[model samples]
Target: MTGAMVTGAPETTGYGGTLAAEAARFAALGWMRGTSGNLSVVTGRDPVRLLVTASGLDKGELRPGDMVLVDEEGTAVPGATAAGKPSAEAALHARVVRLTGAGAVVHVHTVASVAMGRRRPGGIAFRDLEMLKGLGRSAHDEEVVLPVIRNSQDMSVLGDRLEAALDPGVPAVVVAGHGLYAWGADLREARRHTEVVEWLLELQLAEERGR
Candidate 1:
């Protein structure tokens, strides 16, 4: 395909718009400060194409233009006028989507997530919280474990580690000393999982302090 070739992306739809809005909101909360996080939403499934944030762009300033459409292999669609490069961790997003049948994925570097992951390298479990309902967990004392894997730069290695550690039932994974990865059937559900997991970690921190 020629460099001038343009691929079809969601122009009329607001998928990118929603991601940008959430990126800005998370930036305000320091979840994605300094462009430390990445977000993606699947645009097409037949050829497995998704819109991922560009590498090194400030999440606070995240906009649709900062997103690039890429296929499952992390290659930019042949006919898209995409100027931004897909995130370096796009492979991870691809894995999450494929493994979980997710339509969207979110990765964020939040203090509480990093802290909790570091504290429990294996994983952390939450229970007795009403917010657990957000994850489809019973609001009673049922336990929900969010998997944690050691942080690694090699996408292949990290992918393997995540595959082994991830709990299929959970919507997110914590990267020790790194951050969290959340996904769902769509952007709205993915964002909800991200928010709920982050909230649980923050609450855990507060509760630990009281001890």
Candidate 2:
């Protein structure tokens, strides 16, 4: 345990490659510019282990070895590897999974999400958009509210607020002036939820500007 380590040897699995690809994809879309975002996938459920993107690496350039295994509390597990530290927000990601039973989580910075979160710190509500279906919601007349929680330097404080505001029906939440966090049953679903929520926020921002 003197050196870095992970359980079940995730390095031998495809988790790293999957995370790297997703990070690169989001980076290309400008949501994960530089090293500002992180993505993770659940590797175990009984004790809740995950493979999260290591901290401080350029999301656009993450490699197959750029992942760290962490426990339910987001503490890196001691085993055997050189994978760097877990993302600063790894705890929040873990909390999301515990709360929602999501298999993957995507946290990213986006202009629309930041702007909307800042403007509506209480929460942002959406309805009557076909895109709602993408979030697994009714697209006709029902409402979907994406919770917004104030950002905190302490992950514990942030996590507590997130828990208080989380809507079981919603797969996404915005950290005011920070970014958005989206999760789903898996990486692909999480990515789709992120994109759909971001699109909805963009549309709302545009409508507000026009008003």
Candidate 3:
């Protein structure tokens, strides 16, 4: 947030190492199996340039150089240094950042998220849970409906639906039949939000099964 938004691609990606580490952690949890998920960090604001994890590489084995610089449209910056291609979902990630001003984004394929996306495609409501505070919501007597948007192969289509379904108060969104996307002021906060939302979704699924 300190430097001005550079109009061109940055020569060095200062966040690659951190993002690689985070991606490995998520991969270890089985939330980012194979190359199924991606992590991104905002490098600029006004123009919204970000460093996103490269596509088709095992998230668990990502190196510091395994990333690509992309613009708001998810197109790789022409002169950006990159070890691989940008993830297919980069556009949606950019959309989230543009809409929310989030500093970082985490996308993962968690079982709980996929299940809830299918079970509650419209949306899933959470209430009266202490964990709600983790998502910046009141702990008690509060209801939060996490948006669930249908998935699409085209990032534009997916981004459109996500824009319509987004809850400004909610930092996370579930892609029905696909996965979860979470964001925050930074990578740490984004990761925390991702974990909290996933946990809440798991609890919701359990409650439904018990009833």
Ranking by TM-score: 2, 3, 1
Q: Top TM-score: which candidate number?
A: 2
Which sections of candidate 3 miss by over 4 Å? 1-13
lDDT of 3 by residue, 62-146 (tens): 8878888889888888767647689879998898888898999999999899999999989999999999999999988889999
Candidate 1 wrong stretches, greater than 4 Å: 1-6, 9-13
Residue 169 lDDT, candidate 3, scale 0-100: 90
For model 3 the local lDDT of residue 112 reads: 92
Which clashing pairs does model 2 show? 5-79, 5-80
Q: How far off is residue 53 in model 1, in Å?
A: 0.9
> CA lDDT of 54 in candidate 3?
90
**TM of each candidate vs. truth:** 0.92, 0.94, 0.94
Q: Candidate 1 residues 84-145, lDDT tens each?
A: 68777998898877777798899999999999998988889888899999999897868899
Task: Give the per-residue lDDT of model 2 (tens digit) for 119-154.
Answer: 999999999999999988999879789999999989
Sort the candidates on lDDT, descending order.
2, 3, 1
Q: Please report the TM-score between candidate 1 and the true structure.
A: 0.92
Query: Cα-based RMSD of the predictions, in order?
Result: 3.9, 3.7, 2.0
